[model samples]
Target: MPNHQLLNNMTHHDVKIITDYSTDYGDNISTVMTFPTEFGDIQKEYPIFFRKYPDSEEFQAVVMLGLFQNDNLFLQAGNWQANYIPGAITRGPFAIGFQDQSADGGSEKAPVVHIDMDHPRVNTEKGHPVFLEHGGNSPYLEHISNIFTHMMDGIEVGKTMFAAFKQFDLIEPIELEVTLEGDQVHKLHGNYTVSQTKLNELSAENLQALHRAGFLEAAYLVRSSLSNIQKLVNWQNQKMQQQVTSA
Candidate 1:
């Protein structure tokens, strides 16, 4: 259970967070929600996919970090091997929370930073300080602020992008089957991807529409990112080999 509280310089003047990536900190996720805003950055390092919730017909973009649950292939020896860490992963224990505030004679939801006091990273001991000596944001806190901004922006853009993809009928269920070392077979289900055929088959007007909206390239990125799945297989092979040697 997360103990969330609005971040206050006075109340959390001594809050610090460990800047480490490891399973001990619950970084062993195989997949995470990504955004079209980050498609360029994410597609280069991780294979991107889409999935629809059981109760919702809307699609969401996701990036693959490993093959299955509890397996983060990028996590290695207390460090994340990937060059671009997902904002969700690096956000640590901070999140954007909304609070009602009066503005222009009307109340509205205002964005405020919230901290998870019970997160494993949170501490009063050594780590990146959340605030400066007295009562100001530290360099680390400033970086986290930037992350929330991009995350929020990404989410907004993603909604439009996914709507466009659905409008164009480009999202399709993917049948991904892989045979790893030692004849180990794995199949991924219930995930979606941008269909190259459908994307290419679109009318010129639709193509131009997607181009103007800046989503055509994002669709291509999702299609091209599948190549990274091979990299995952190779990494899994090496991990299995290491285990065999140590055994």
Candidate 2:
């Protein structure tokens, strides 16, 4: 469970967060939730896929980092090798939370920044400070705020994008069979990817709608990102070779 608390300068004035990526810091993720807004940069490094949400059964976009769970190949000697890290990963222990507010004779929920008190990155001794010595938000905190805003907007856009894809029947299951060194076989299931066939078959009107909504390019980006799977395989093979040589 996450011990999330509303971030406040007074209570967390001295809080510092680890900004580096490492397995020790719990960055060894197989996939990270991504949104359409990030597809351009994420597609440059990771294979984009869709998975059903456990509770809502809604499709959500993600960028695969490794072939299996807890197998982030991008982490090297406590450094993330990728040129662009997903905003979900870069946000670290901070997240957007909601607070009830009364506005204009009505009640509404407002987004607030929350921090995980138990995350490994949360500390007082080292890393980037959340607040300045004079009780103001630090540059790091400002960056986190910006990330939160973008993430929130991206989430709304992602929902519309996925809905459009589903309506057009453009998503299909992705199956992968991999043979590692020593004939170790791995089978992956339950992930979905954009269907090039279905996309190509769409009518001109639908294509124009998708183009107007800015989803046509995103679909192509997702399709092109599938090539990154080969990159992942090479990384895995390299690791296996190193292990065999060391042994």
Candidate 3:
């Protein structure tokens, strides 16, 4: 369970967060959740795909980080090897929580930042400080706050986008088979992608509706991001070759 505490500069004065990537910090996943709000930047490097739960038909977007399980090709020596790190990865232990902070005897849900004290990144010494020595927001802290805002707003955006996807019957199952060096093949299942066929077959009125709602470009972005799957395959091949050379 996350021991979430409402972040206040007074109570948590010396909180520091380790921003390095490691398996212990839970960065070894092959995929990280992406948002429609981030599709443009995320699509530039990671291949965006959608997935549904075993019993749930609702689809969520994720960006592929590797060909196989727990293999994040973008992870290097304690650093991520990409210019644009997904907000989910960078947000670390921070979360946004809503509370009624109306001192005037009214009800208004206000978003406040919460910190998970149990997370490995939280430490008293050695890392990026959440607050400066004079009790002001550090650049890193400000950036994380912005990330939380984006992620929170993305919830409704994603919900409506996926609902539109279902309305247009644009999502279809996808099995990505990556052929690496020496005939090594990795098959990724339980993933879905936007169907170009379905997109093309949609009525002009439906296309206009999607376009007006700003979901059409997002759908195309998900499809266009598939091009980066080859990049993951190439990284896997390089890793395999390095293993062979070492052996």
User: Largest TM-score belongs to which candidate?
Assistant: 1
Model 3: lDDT equals 0.90
lDDT of 1: 0.91
Report lDDT (Cα) of residue 242, candidate 2: 96
Query: TM per model?
Result: 0.97, 0.96, 0.92
Q: Which ten residues in a row have the lowest lDDT in candidate 2?
A: 176-185
Q: Per-residue lDDT of 1-247 in model 3, one digit per residue for the tens?
A: 8899999889888999999988888888998888999999999989999988668777789888987788899987778888899999999999888998787788889998999999999999979999988899889899998998888778789999999999999999988787889997778888999999999999999999999999999999999999998888888898889899999
> lDDT for each of the candidates?
0.91, 0.91, 0.90
Model 2, C-alpha of 142: deviation from truth (Å): 0.7
Clashing pairs in 2: none
